[model samples]
Target chain A: MKSPFIAVSKSEFILYLREPSAFFFTLVFPLLMMLLFASMWGNDPFPGEEYGYVDFSVPAFMGLVMATSFIMSLTTSMAAYREKGVLKRFRAAPATPSSILIGQLSAVFAITVAGVILLLIAGIVFYDLRFLGNFFEFVFAFLLSAGSIAALGFIPASLAPTARSGVVIANIMYFPMLFLSGAALPWFMLPDLMKKISLVFPLTHAIKLMQGVWLGGHFWDYPVHLAVLTGFVFAGLFVSVRYFRWE
Target chain B: MTDNVVTVRNLVKHYKDVKAVDGISFSVKRGEIFGIVGPNGAGKTTTIDCIAGMHRAYSGSIDVLGLDPVSDSIALKRRIGLQQQESEIPDRLRLREAMELFSSFYKKALDWKMLLEQLNLWEKKDSFYSALSGGQKKRLFVAMALIGDPEIVFLDEFTSGLDPQARISIWKLVGNLRDQGRTVVLSTHYMDEAERLCDRVAIVDHGKLAALDSPSDLIAAHGGHTRVYFDASEGFDGKSLSLLEGVESFVNRGDACTLEVNARSAIVEIVKTLDVMGQGLDSFRIEAPTLEDVFLNITGRQVRD
Candidate 1:
């Protein structure tokens, strides 16, 4: 007999594949953005910079991918399940609340990894993207960044009363984060006022940590970014477990 | 040991200012199909929700299979199954996959493939949920509920939106569950369903249980009079027919006569008298008292939403 976690995760993974909007955003949308930016900015490295435009943007785009997959996709799916009474059915069964949460997180993380891998391949093949960072450090930074954002997803997932409202809340947060977090536009291009405000967004810290590690810098070199992301991880999970509703 | 599998004492639940369930009490015996029947918003679903532990009552005590529904919810959930009134599966989920997924959520489970076959859904195992018709979707939920081999099953508004043919098919599936010695608690607004399928019926109105008893007993006590109508011949005396035993009253309207009787034997006596009168009866029909009549009698004739 399969464990409930495994069963639920496998079911959720299949459901993720079946949702067209989630598939397009997580896997297809990021690559399209990468191509558009690489073509527009020309892959040549900037003055005194070791990497080209695509190389710098690839890690930042990964942050955007995490936001879409976790903040948008995961929240909407969980809210829709609650609205449809699917969660109620699961609760009536032997499946625990932890099992459902872990299953959803696992599925969203798997899709985020797939999206990131696709973006990386596009950059390395078409734009000659550089990878100067240590592989293990980069992996650690990626996991921490993605895990924190995915945990943060549960806040909207728990608070949204319906799937339609979940989409509204996600978009309200997503569009602002995309423009302010340096995930779409580079950090240096922003004015000092915008940069100061961007520090308040969790996605900003995620991109800072990811970009730092991808550019051959140690993760511990950015203590504040590390702490902020770690704090979000704990706070998000705490709020979700404390208040998540099954129906 | 007591045969009662479920017992509720003064179950009261409130939704803010409105009382959803007001001091309702009932016990369900083992291996019987018990029904909670009422109009829309009469708190039938709310009562089931309380017993299933889906919602906590404002003030009440409930015991299901020797466990409190609130404190021992997880254990009670494992021993019982629920089919909610408005729950749905993902449209993209295949029938076979859904059965398999739900099957893993229990310690002991029936063969899901066999359950599908029993529910007449084996041929559509690979079909997505969106592809099934309304009746088929209802049957699939029942199959999912039974996959865990629960000792008790709660089905809320089991056939609320089904066509007549579909309703009958679902009724047979429910009968099979009762035959397996599993206690079945169901709620429906269709009185005929309660009259035919339920061993005992609890009629609820305005969040209160108006009456609870076997269908026949309720019909006998509060179902009012059974009317026998026939086209009366010219020169027939309605007063003579009214004097017959068990006939409570006689009324003549246009060319027809109606005999209100308190017992089934009164119909035979009236028939014999009509034959002896040589009135040559034509076009006769009987309106027997049913659960609907009992409901109207107890709950008043006001229409409910």
Candidate 2:
């Protein structure tokens, strides 16, 4: 007998693989960003610099991968499932909503991890970047951050009545977070107001954790950032459970 | 064990001011095919939703096999299969994949291959949902509903838009469920479907129970008049036709005359009356009352309208 969680996750993974748009966002888009940013700014910023911006930008792109794969993708798919009556059908079946959500979030986590690994490899092979931190610690923080962001995705999914509405809600958070949370730029380059504004988004702490792990910084140094990300996880998950509509 | 598979007492559901299911009560017996027939907005779907634990009735006591539908929904779901009116699978999902996904939800599921074959969809198992025709899609839903080997199945408007061939195939499948001793609760406005498949039907009108009985009994009780039509091969007195023993009224449509008669043996009386009038009956048609007639009689409106 197969566990319902695994069964649902496996099918969700297959569905994620089958969608061309999921392919574009999860794997192709992030890889292109890595290649684009690495080639365009190959050399470092200073006069005597030898390394390009890719060395600094690669970890942020990993954060980008998590957001696209979990937040954007999960929100749109969940809303679409609700709209198509898939969620209601499952409710009528022996499946529990918790199992479905777990399976879906786990699938999203797995796919986003795969995309991140590929991005890291591309950065190493093309731009000569290397992980400077403990591998186990990096993996743990990466997954936790990804799970938190995926929970954030579920909030909009539970609230939106349709896929179009879900996209609208996701984009309102997604583009702004991508720009302000250091995924599209280095954190030090942001103006004071923008940096302060980014503090309110979960993506900011996610990027910070990823960058800290990549740069060999002490994992326990930023307890406040960890707490903020963890807060998002609890809050997002609660809201999703409270508002989800099976029909 | 109780013989009744489902029971609803004083069921009422309100959405703001509209009473979707107002003061309705019915019971479905074990191992029988029960149907709910009503026009659109007549509360058929609302009633089923409440029974299926999808909605909470404002005032009601609903029991399915001795369990409250809402409070014991988890257990109820394990025993009952539901094919909702508007439910659909993902367009990109293949038929086989969908069956596998749904089967995994249960502790012990029916074999997917067997279900596919039973639904006559084995060859299309590998086809994506978007690739299947509308009838095939409906069959796939039926297959999914039965995948868990549920004790009871609820099919809402199961054959609404299918062709005659497809409708007959589904009707046969539903009949098979009854033969296997599984209770089925069907809600549809198709009187012919209810007439053919249901052991008993509850006719609902304007959110209330208008009548409930075996289809034949209801037809016998409420299907008041038979319709008779005859071509006017010769000139006939229209007012004199109304005075015939069984004739309730007569309509003269120039070349033909239509008679609404109150008695089943009115056809014999109509022919005799035509014979005594010295008119040649070039063509005559006698139509017996059907479930549709019963429904029209009770509701005073067509099911579709």
Candidate 3:
């Protein structure tokens, strides 16, 4: 028997492939992002060592891809589907509505995993960035980041009326998180007040977790990021479920 | 009770201040092609919407296959198929894919290839929904509504903007549904169509049912006047037939004069007068009243003012 979830998941993946720009952003852009941001923070930005920016930013780029593909991409596409009565049609059918939703998530899930794998290879080969802490922290952080971003995607999906507006809403959400979460740049150079505000966003927590993993920072730092990301995951998922308009 | 497949009682639906369906009641018999005919905003759509479990009427009881659409919605919905007015299905799906997707909902489904052949959509099997023409889209919709093998189907304005040939093809398709013992509740504004296909019709206007019955019965009751055409035996002007009992209007056409008699009583009087005079009658035929006349009789000659 065919798994029902695979029906929607495979269909969504196939359709998304037809859009060249979305495919590039979800799959290829993360690598470019890793290179550009890694180069900017200094070819070797780690203190007391020669861990290149490629090494430092690779981990951050993993987290960044999770946010863009899982949260931003999922939310925008879902909003467009809602605007076009796609959700409405599913509601009428006894077919797998939830499976279709999960299918859309699966597309993001695959994209994020691919980006993570590429980042891992680049970090190993070029940057020589070692995993100094428990593998579980890195793994746990990866899952949480993906879930948190997926949940947060609901907010923009709820507010954006059309696909175009969804793009704008995502940009409004992403740019600030990119700059402040230390994904685009580190917060160490900012004044204390600016650094304090950055702490509020999940990006800060994602960054802090990865930064801790590299230096083997105390596990205590890991929980704070996890806690923030966990809280956001619940809130974003809840609001998205409550307000998602299917046309 | 056995004869009826659907029964709606005291159906009253209100939206804000306006009553969309006001205290209407009707029943559709099993395996019959029932039509509800009305103009735009005539409450036919609202009435069907309530019956489809899509809307909650303010005060009404709609029972389809002995189940209330609102209260027993899931059970009722599973059995009834609906085609929304101007409903746009999504793109990014093949014609066959759409059929497969919707058919997955039901325990028993019509065969996709069989349905495609019926709609003439088989050759366009690989085409996406957006690539289909308007008639093709309508045919696809009809196909989708039937794919689930619904016992009773509700179609709202099924063929509003189609070329004449497509319209006739759809009417034939609707006829086939009744032949297979499936009940269909159709709503359309086309009078000639309602007359041709409806086993029974509910004529609605201003949110109330103006008349309801078989085509012939409705004509017998409210269809008033049987028009007759005959030569007013020479030397007798059509003017000589002025103000006769049943004759509502008279016009002389060269040798033949047409008379619009008000009732069967007027026809008897006209026949007696013409026969007693012993004048040469050129030609004569009694024209039965149509649904349009019933509409005018009920709504008045003003045409929906």
For each candidate, the DockQ is 0.68, 0.64, 0.32
| Candidate 1 ranges beyond 4 A from true positions | A43-46, B302-305
TM-score of chain B of each: 0.95, 0.92, 0.86
The digit string of per-residue lDDT tens for model 1 on A192-232 reads 99999998888899999888889889999999999999999
The number of clashing residue pairs in model 1 is 0
> In model 1 chain B, where is the ten-residue run with the lowest total lDDT?
B296-305
Ranking of predictions according to TM-score = 1, 2, 3
Is model 1 an incorrect, acceptable, medium or high docking prediction? medium
Ranking by DockQ: 1, 2, 3
Model 1 Cα lDDT, one tens digit per residue, B1-305: 78999998898899989998999999999999999999989999889988887874458788899998877877888889888887888889999989989988888989999988988899999999989998789888888888889999999998988899888888998898999999999999989998999999999988888999999999999989999999987766878789999999999987788889988999988888888888665777899988988888898863244
Between candidates 1 and 2, the one scoring higher on DockQ is 1
lDDT for each residue of candidate 3 in B1-305, tens digit (9 for 90 to 100): 37888888889998889988898899999988898988888899888878876654458777788887767765776687887775555577788877776666666778988999998999998898889988898888888888878899888899988899999999999999989889999998888889999999999998999999998888888887788988665567665465677689988877778888877788777777777667555576789888878888887752334
Question: Candidate 1, after superposition: displacement of residue A55 in Å?
Answer: 2.3
Highest-scoring model, DockQ: 1
**Evaluation by TM-score, superior candidate among 2 and 3:** 2
Winner by TM-score: 1
Candidate no. 3 TM-score:
0.83
Residue B259 CA displacement from its true place in model 2, Å: 4.8
RMSD of candidate 2 to the truth, in angstroms, is 2.7
For residues A20-131, what per-residue lDDT tens digits would candidate 3 score against the true structure? 7777876677777776665555355457864556666666777778778866787678777777766655544444334555667887788788878887786677566666
Show the lowest summed lDDT stretch of 10 residues, model 2 chain A.
A43-52
